[model samples]
Target: MSVEETMNYVLKIPWHDIERNLISRVQLKKIIKLRIILDKREINYPIYFYVGEKRDHVMIPYVFCSCKNFTIRVMSKKKKPSCKHLIMLRLALDKSMYREIYIDDLTLLKKIINEIIRIGLSPTLRKLLYISRNRRYERGRTDGA
Candidate 1:
């Protein structure tokens, strides 16, 4: 088996154990520096943001992360199931290690939307998509006149 495949096989094992013992020294160091921000404005369910050095990554606990590492390695390559930010988030949430901070819903939504657009979509794609949306809205307004 190749190195990538071997690592993939190794990481497919139970995450907690691997995360605790096998996570790289660099990742371990980064784990402590990462921040988990919990937005509990909605009592029914809360939103989590993994605040990284360069950007904030939105995640739903074990489900997702908006980082390139998660998108490239975990999702596309399948070489690893979770990124360092994700592991830090899971640990913080389960252990209640995260500090609660209040950010109004509107501000939080703005941050989420901006971050997602910045990282989730390429510039050309974003321009094309938003331009099309504006054109559609203009057409609808004209049609109603």
Candidate 2:
């Protein structure tokens, strides 16, 4: 998407479910199946998914990815910024978000995913966890408390 198009999506007409990527100017549909597998031991699993009318697709190895946008825009040496997938990859490596995954370690990713499955993931549970941890702030428990 071009800068002008992105701006229109963000300003002129807003998408209800659109979320601002903390690290980029793009508004991406919620990323699903936060999966990461590298090295020979990685298991067959679902990774990043596109949220659109079509069915979800799997994330191929970066080099092998169709990468139409990047190939068209970057390979020919355009002046635009990188694509969303590349931006996502850079975010994953930044150590700022997605603290659950170990960007450099496959073993850690496996362990985290297994734990999430075992404990279960739910919006209510997540909200409850947040509230419980920030009880002091949420309920105004200040120094006087």
Candidate 3:
């Protein structure tokens, strides 16, 4: 029998691990940064990041980021796995542990509601969560490549 390696689906991550390892340290040095930029009017505001002052946005669900490492390492032919920014987002939404600072702000709630009104809740979330492939392939092409 031949042994084959299989890829794991990482669409969902366990929330507890992220909080325990990552979120608990946000207030420590202030060098590693992750900010959900929600206006009092809209939830679509970008996520601001600062890893050694290099800024990026970690678009959730699909886990896309603007950091150079993500662009060159993950997006540009060199297929690497997830980065710390993606993991940060995964752990950002803690349910039972500490309060997520972004969501705790009442202004952010109004923005989320306004965003939901603009696009409807389901569609907005779908757009946020859809893991789209690069444009090199055809739109509907699916052959299990």
Candidate 4:
């Protein structure tokens, strides 16, 4: 298999399921660092990261790195999967030395929304959400609501 596939497979294994004796913390850190370096060298995009606090545990959501390609398409009003950024983020997380953070598809959106809420931008986001929902509703309706 290709190196990317192999690394992805290794990272796909949940941290809880992995044997503690098989992988050392130091090794995990090394993996994360290497992935970050590779991502920096290859992908030229902005990455969004989120951290949350709990009583004793910290909540680190999945990473979302938006591709310049995807952003450009979005600006041009097109829909497409800019997989390069996602791949880079995955590669980084898979190889990360830290065990706390998990990268999922919703990670980026959730982080951004949470930040908006935190900064009291809820009203604006709510309006946008409402407009989006209404647009979908109108599209589905036989008569305009």
Candidate 5:
């Protein structure tokens, strides 16, 4: 199903029902315990930070998450459209389940950048570089010939 459809479905139904079917026990636990901080200073686009047991993840609601689960499973393998954090955020928004913490936009951006630096380049970035190098090589060969 499309992202929109999935989000709409989740929003329409209660979290309890959706939790039983879609979320695993471990994910459910995280959802309950996770601290969601919202930086809504930017009126057009709000930033969400999900503080998990081990690490903090930067998310853009339903759009993206800095978690490995999202990068590997959702983006790389296509096993799922979203990670537990994203689903939790969606549910939280609908049911008012999250704790609203105020963070300034600049600090939030710095935190997100730091998180990315700590995690290093993702698989998508490596793939993009590889493709770019191959294109340069192909162009060079044609010009040399």
Candidate 6:
């Protein structure tokens, strides 16, 4: 299969079910299996699989997560998106968003940040951009940030 096709297949594999049923039941075994699959495909870096809102979601390093992991990481880095963690998070979040999860508009800003990170932009530039944009919404922001 083409790379794109393979990726689609992998992403569609009912991660939520696996997380809920399989993960806790056989944590080590499932992780080993997942590691083998990722390794065979040469997918480096950590890929977090978890259940969110009863749906399975994968949090790659640079991807955004509704679970707040990405936001926490970015905020900890002072809005910087330089780390590999951020990059993977972006990739994972983009994929998830494309799957039609009804994400709130409040998370749109973080999505933009994820895109910027994916494009190889410098972290300093990203931080500056985030600050500028954040100011625009500061007055009436209800995003619970």
Most accurate candidate by lDDT: 5
Runs with alpha carbons beyond 4 Å of true place in candidate 3: 1-10, 14-61, 95-145
Query: What C-alpha RMSD separates each model from the true structure?
Result: 15.2, 12.2, 19.0, 17.7, 17.7, 16.9
Report the C-alpha lDDT of model 4 over 1-145, residue by residue, as the tens digit.
3334334544464556554533453343311110122333543233323211211111122222233443454223445332232333344456553322222334444554455435523333234344655777789895665
* Model 3, span 1-145: residue lDDT tens: 0011101223355555555546654333212222344455434443433232223232433355555565676667456665555555444433222122233254544454455344333232223223322322445565444
Q: Pick out the ten consecutive residues of candidate 5 with the lowest summed lDDT.
A: 27-36
lDDT of 5 by residue, 14-93 (tens): 56656653344334333221122456433434665555535666666676778888788877777776677777777666
* Candidate 1 Cα misplacement greater than 4 A, ranges: 1-41, 116-145
Model 1, C-alpha of 16: deviation from truth (Å) = 7.7
Alpha-carbon TM-score of each model against the true structure: 0.50, 0.28, 0.37, 0.24, 0.53, 0.19
Lowest lDDT sum, 10 consecutive residues, model 3, at 1-10
Residue 78 alpha-carbon offset, candidate 6, angstroms: 8.8
**Candidate 5's TM-score:** 0.53
- Model 2, 125: alpha-carbon shift in Å? 25
- Tens digit of per-residue lDDT, candidate 1, span 1-145: 3345434543444555645542442243322211223574344344555444456566555656678887788778877756766666656654465533333345545555475557752333234334655878899999998
The lDDT, on a scale of 0 to 1, for candidate 6 is: 0.36
TM-score-based ranking: 5, 1, 3, 2, 4, 6
Tens-place lDDT digits, model 2, residues 101-130 = 113365544444443345433333234334
Worst 10 residues of 6 by lDDT: 28-37
Count clashing residue pairs in model 5. 0
How many backbone overlaps does candidate 1 show?
0
Worst 10 residues of 1 by lDDT: 28-37
Best by TM-score: 5
Off by over 4 Å in 4: 1-121, 143-145
lDDT of each: 0.52, 0.38, 0.39, 0.36, 0.56, 0.36
